[model samples]
Target: MNVPMLTTDFLDRGVELYDDVTGVIADDGTEYTYAEFGERVDRLSNALLDMGLEQGDKVALVSGNTHYFLETQFAVQQLGMVFVPINYRLIADEYEYILNDCDAKVVVADHAYADEIQPIRESVPADTFVGYGADRIEGDWHEYEDVLQSGAPESPERPDIAEDDDATINYTSGTTGDPKGVVRTHRTEHVHALILAHHMELVDDDTYLWTLPMFHCNGWGHTYAVTGLGATHVCQRAFDAADTFATIREHDVSYLCGAPTVINRLIEEYERNEPETTGDRPVRITTAGSPPPKAQIEQVEDQFGWKLIQIYGLTETAPLITTSNSNRRIAQTDRAADLKVRQGSATLSTQIRVVDEDGEDVPQDDETMGEVVVKGNQVMDRYLNKPEITHDAFNERVEGWFHTGDVATVDEDGMIQIKDRRKDIIITGGENVSSIEVEDTLYDHPDVQKAAVVGTPDDDLGEKVTAIVVEKDDADLTAAEIEQFARERMANYKIPRRIEFEDDLPETATGKVQKYEIREEYWEGESRRI
Candidate 1:
């Protein structure tokens, strides 16, 4: 008999084999074995279904990196309900849009985000609201622990969950308009977990750190992968170098993932603390977003004694299609650091190619730049409720291939290296910032005539969000003034860190601002373009 693929399979395998093994380590100072954790998941899953959450209902999760977030990930999907994890960094209005946009039936959040969610409850209300941990806001909500205990611990109603069932709707940043919800199925998420386990070599002995937010592509699907293998998950409430280092040592963390900006921060913290190095077992970290400069990679490895493995993908593709880790050729050679910064080859079973404007494969000389397109099992099904946009995304260039909107090249060894992004996106600290969003906010300033936003190379953030402008003839707008205007309109990370005012900006004949000219100086010594 052929068993259908489902994310719950991971948990099933863990309970069958590693029932006695520790499954999760929460920063809340609580630990649970596979058997206990599985019971809680069963109870929570039963609770939601018992509380009138029908199959296919959308449940919104709002929180940072915490254990409750991890538990909800498995619970909601047990009965085939769709889980929508919102980014905690978004403003109140953004949260309201996503909550209402997804038509969420339930809103589950931790007390840390009460200030943001408490106000939005009046505007976008869910059928049920649940809060966990201390300091929960005053609202119509039940405590998480109470709910978890209220449900039956035995197996809940199993709704014939299939691989093709609608699983998650991950909302990506909106550069032009409202954020688009990228819809993914169980098959996509299930395969992504397998790929992560295979490439990262996750085993029962590995203790994975929860440095990445569980909201980001379901923590890039590691929640399932690591838990399935019966490996211990060391969860964190926040990302601070001191706390992260303490957790790594405290839990004996073996692996983690983050952007280049995160690695930079860890490196800085490691130097200041001067902690005793990992003598026998070095921590392995996976870095993505803009590839870290080779020098930064070297610094992280040398200082912290952690192996840096780079991977690349977007939230649309179940978050991972390519990785730059464990290449035998690169590992055996002396130039591993240089090769590590390239996004490297496709992940297991993932097919990637660099093609020119006509969709033909670019030469493998690695000099010619082209758009990076890919076809894989893990690609998202489509954008939720946006059929036209989804059709346009795949109809471009190739018939079935998904356009990545990233410019890159393929080397003779078949390794793909990202050169730049075709879309006007600024990836600072691993977060995608739409340049158009920032530019629109800049234009809102009464004194601003023309504005352009671009990424500038920085030692920490990888790319610093920078804005260049052509001020109104008689108006004088300082960098601080522009930044203040932007902060009021957008998230803190989206605000321009550096702003420059000029009499006139270089523009094309059609009156479009040529951002490359403005961005050229800051990136002169850089190896990769945005």
Candidate 2:
């Protein structure tokens, strides 16, 4: 048995076995074998070194899900450098904050995002700024292709790294304001990769399609795990429902991981028209950004015949901690409908608990609610430069638990059902109400497609309940009708005092309804983070 020490080991081992096979299929139809991928990473590593980039230095990669993004990832790890993947959607100041904070010595940007990088050029003091893709823009940056050609096509010596050595710094999307840097170690990455591979049932035969942005927790660590298992990667620069369907048919993608929103969009397209595929079809899709509705889950199975496994985790948790894998109990049950509701049990390497403020364990009696806590190798090392936050995140007095701000309950069968984020809980007239519960109830309605409940301002009550709804096409949904539906299912206090109908709800990059964004209007001038 061989123990893995480097993240780059995935490509090295993959190429040795599947050197000639198409390992990466780009959108432009460009294919790269494992051997070619390894060579590109080696050249990228050598190029960084030649540009005077030292080990442990920060290198920022700003792009979507592209082959170069994947190459830069392994290259940074090979040279013992920290790969800082910046959110391409982030505004100039946000990008500037990341660059200035990380002090990145090199910035590898996507050519499509040239406008975003142009204004911020003066802010980055890196030795090199390489732009990927075909075409040249007048700038001080070097072409991505030119850099690879300038350096030797060989990987530098692997870094003498300990298990605790920092590998990457993932900037988490903040619901309130500025993004926080979550530092992850190589051990955390390696362990999480193995955990994801096992939990998601990833094997050598699996062909993964990248639908989620790679900037997001390294696409929930699928980048390494897929390669580790010698799985082919169908890389897409950007996500489109049509393109996604076409790729699934073209490559016969066996597995993919994305947010619930991605699944919803695909399901919408699928319902409009059935897609025909000639090759291997996708068998599984792991979703985690937000818990998908049961209707969406059923649609995935009914339409594409794919097993939609729901997972839950954040960028801080190395992205894969708990999953809703279908078990024998579900397979044998008449209630496949009920099983989809629970986010399910923890993975083999993950230990999950629902604890109270006192840090004692909450009862496994489904009715009891508590804050969800986890302790695992997948947990992040710390929040970079935020010791206070890091300290709060990893508390030792409560039996050394990493406090996940999520509130949840565990059923008798040991299934963990997340209720809501601790901050998202609503308190009206001294009563604690779960917005998710209200949202769930609203989702049960026939006309409702998407629902987000937020605590709005109220002179009488401390905070009034408000629900924003998106009605299905051609479905007649009025505020009075929705109010009546909520009134029957929920307590009068939990019912929305105000209802607003929208064509679409504001969403995060991952498709999670930015409840915070919706709540912001109601919470104008308020000092609270909620």
Candidate 3:
């Protein structure tokens, strides 16, 4: 008999098997068992039910890595209500667009970020406002604790949720235009969590630390996987190098996820003041958002004694389709770092192909670059209210597979290495250059702290390869020296013809270099060709 696979199955299993086990450790160090956590979720569901919320309604949350954020996810989803988690780093105008776009009926925000929503509260469609710390917030909001107290702790009446029912809507960064809501169903998220749990080797005895934001693809789907496995969650309010190390020791955190920017901060902190890296348990970190430098990965493993795993995907794809965590392949080669650096082979039941413009799969040469396309259960159902855009995204280049705008190459072992973003690829006079290739070469230089390569408008070469670099402290580097260093490493066309030094490069909330923002500065007058 085929039963509907719902996201609520995770929490149901957790409560049944590990009711007395510690389920969550809040940011402020408060601990709650699975029984207590399940009751709180039921209470919040009843509260929303009393507020006139029904099935197919939307509940938006703006919170940090807190216990309530975890509670809200299950609470709203259990009632067949769609959960919308907004990026707390976004501004008022962005929040306004999202709230109105989703037609959120109730908005639950953290005290620290409630002000951003307060200014535009009246303009949005939301009727009820709830704050985690309502006393500190200026707006007229119901306290989160009071709302839970108002409802009964028993299970609220649940709707007949199907496998295809909408589970959540995660918004893209919208660097180019308005952020698009990626609508995912219960089956997509449920399957993705199972795949992730298997690939990450998650176990009930593991302790997970929340260094990544909960809003980011539902904390990369860890909110479900970690809880479903009956593991402990130690939430950190915000990412701090000192706090990360201390928390790892204090809670014996076994696993966590972060972007490359987070890894850089930890490396810098380790260099400045050496700290104990782990507690009694071994530690493992998963990095994504951008390809991390080899040096950083080595430093994390060798210096910090932590395992680093690289994953690849976007918000639209349930945030995880590939991971470079193969022990079998790594053991066969002495160059484990090289294999670890690549966005390794596809995860179980996922099909990944690097194809040329003609929609034909490229050879596994590891040199010929092509766009990465994928077909998997984890892919989103559609972009909400954007049918035309969704059709174009899926139909473009290939018929059914989702086109991942990332240009990459597949090795003989089917290991895919991302070259550059399709828009970020630099086209000189006649040849195409990968900006990531150039940046990776620059990172090899000891003096180079950070680098971003962009194509600048040029009359002769169509577009000249340019580099914006951040040098190490106390290092006085010259543009000529950098060019000479590039000459020894890469081809003449791939080398940055123009180099500019900067104190620091602009980064996104996830720590990716804002290349589009950097491109806007250089291509002020003329439109960039690529």
Against the true structure, whose lDDT is highest?
3
Candidate 2's displacement at residue 513, Å, is 2.3
lDDT of 2 by residue, 8-37 (tens): 667677878887777787767799988898
For residues 1-530, what per-residue lDDT tens digits would candidate 3 score against the true structure?
99987899899988889999999999999999999999999999999999999999999999999999989999999999999999889999999999999999999999999999999998999989999999999969999999988889999888899999999999987655578999999999999999999988899989999999889889888999999999999999899999999999999999998998788888878888899999998999999898887877888899999999989999888888898899999899887778888899899989999999999999999999999999999999999999999998898999999998999999999999999888988999989998998988898898888999999998999999999999987899999999999999999889899999999998766677888888988787875455
Output the lDDT of residue 504, model 1.
68
**Residue 426, candidate 3: C-alpha displacement in angstroms:** 0.6
Can you rank all candidates by TM-score, best first?
A: 3, 2, 1
TM value for model 1: 0.81
Q: What alpha-carbon RMSD in Å does predicted model 3 have with respect to the real structure?
A: 1.2
User: How far off is model 1, as Cα RMSD?
Assistant: 10.6
- In model 1, state the lDDT of residue 159: 90
Could you give candidate 1's per-residue lDDT for residues 38-101 as a string of tens digits?
A: 8998889988977898899999988878777777888988889999998776778988998888
lDDT at 372, model 2? 83
Candidate 2 backbone collisions, by pair:
252-280
TM-score (all chains, Cα) for each model: 0.81, 0.95, 0.98
**Winner of 1 and 2 under lDDT:** 2
**RMSDs, each prediction?**
10.6, 2.1, 1.2
